[model samples]
Target: YEKSSTILTSNKSYGEWGEIFKDHVIAAALLDRILHHCTTINIKGESYRLKERKKQGIKTGLIRHNSTEILEN
Candidate 1:
């Protein structure tokens, strides 16, 4: 485990992982192992996709229908 590197990226915070795995116990155990030998980096900013859309003069509006959302130009 020493001298090894791993990268993991997630938009969800640690507290929200339980919902993802559908079991708090499993999430906790997995996090314990991963975090035991991990370095965390939190990034905060506008999404790169949105920034690129804005730069390209693409409309960033959404049209909703029922539970689905369609992006509009």
Candidate 2:
């Protein structure tokens, strides 16, 4: 038998995932499964979208987030 690999990618950190899913319990379960026997790699850099905008002479500004509103119903 051969083993298969699964790949999951996210722009947010593990702690911030509850906001993305709107449920901390679900996020925990999902993460638990994916992280079991998994290897992790983190890549950091300026976003490609922002990089291209800068190249085209378009000004870009830092994006701000309000944590309180993220999981609002």
Candidate 3:
């Protein structure tokens, strides 16, 4: 496995992964192995779950507008 390519996916960030694994040493070891030849990609955006709810006609209520003058004041 060490000489082969690999792919991994996780919803949690690296910092949160320590807590998720419940062992800092093991998490570090796991990361070291997985990341050895990995190309890390960070994909960040609004949750797909929320988008589905919106399409289902979920009421999100009014959108707030911010004025420049309010910030200046």
Candidate 4:
């Protein structure tokens, strides 16, 4: 980081990141260096996991009008 720039992306927020890094001092130091020369971008959108689940439901006929019969027949 000192010799070159770095970029990072996380699904967790800053306040929720302590749980991710699992070390207070390390997390704080890393965050300090990152925030020192970084442009933080907060991307808000539906979770990719949920979107994939919906797509899987459509593919598997889980959301069909006759889901059970579609499966049996």
Candidate 5:
């Protein structure tokens, strides 16, 4: 996929990947490869669902968040 773009999304922090996958070595390696050339779009919990609810004039139970942080290597 050279010259093509790849986008990955996640709500959990990279540090927790080991716990989620139950393997620190593998999780770290996977994270390393992803960070090698790809960009990380760190999106918070609000996501699209929360955004649409607000746009439709609905009151969501939880407070909404808005932002995306880019992690580049």
Candidate 6:
């Protein structure tokens, strides 16, 4: 990864990594290297899956929208 470009996606924030990964030290070390030459751009909105479900008349009942939208660069 250090010699080439890589792309990763995570819905959780930095502070939540300790709990997300179940180890603060490992999370910290991992983030340290990843963020060294990283560019972060956050996009917040309703999930397209839900949107399509709604279009198909599937009842989601007001659940929180968690979308994984791809970024093109």
Highest TM-score: which candidate?
1
TM-score of each: 0.70, 0.67, 0.63, 0.54, 0.64, 0.67
Number of the top-ranking candidate, with lDDT as the measure: 5
Tens-place lDDT digits, model 2, residues 1-73: 1299676777788899989999999999988777776677765655667878888988777554423212211
Give me the runs in candidate 5 sitting further than 4 Å from their true place. Answer: 1-3, 51-65
Model 1 lDDT per residue over 6-58, tens place: 87889788899999999999999998888885567665655656778878989
**What is the C-alpha lDDT profile of model 5 across 44-65, one tens digit per residue?**
5575667788899898887646
lDDT of 3 by residue, 20-72 (tens): 98998889998777666557776565555677778899966635343322111
| Steric overlap count per candidate | 0, 0, 0, 0, 0, 0
Which lDDT value does model 5 have at 3?
Answer: 82
Q: 2 or 3: which has the higher TM-score?
A: 2
TM-score of 4: 0.54
How much is the lDDT of residue 34 in candidate 1? Answer: 81
| Model 4 per-residue lDDT tens digits across residues 1-73 | 4687566777677776677888777878877766875566665644545668776764433332321111110
* Residue 52 accuracy (lDDT) in model 3: 77
Lowest lDDT 10-residue stretch of candidate 3: 64-73
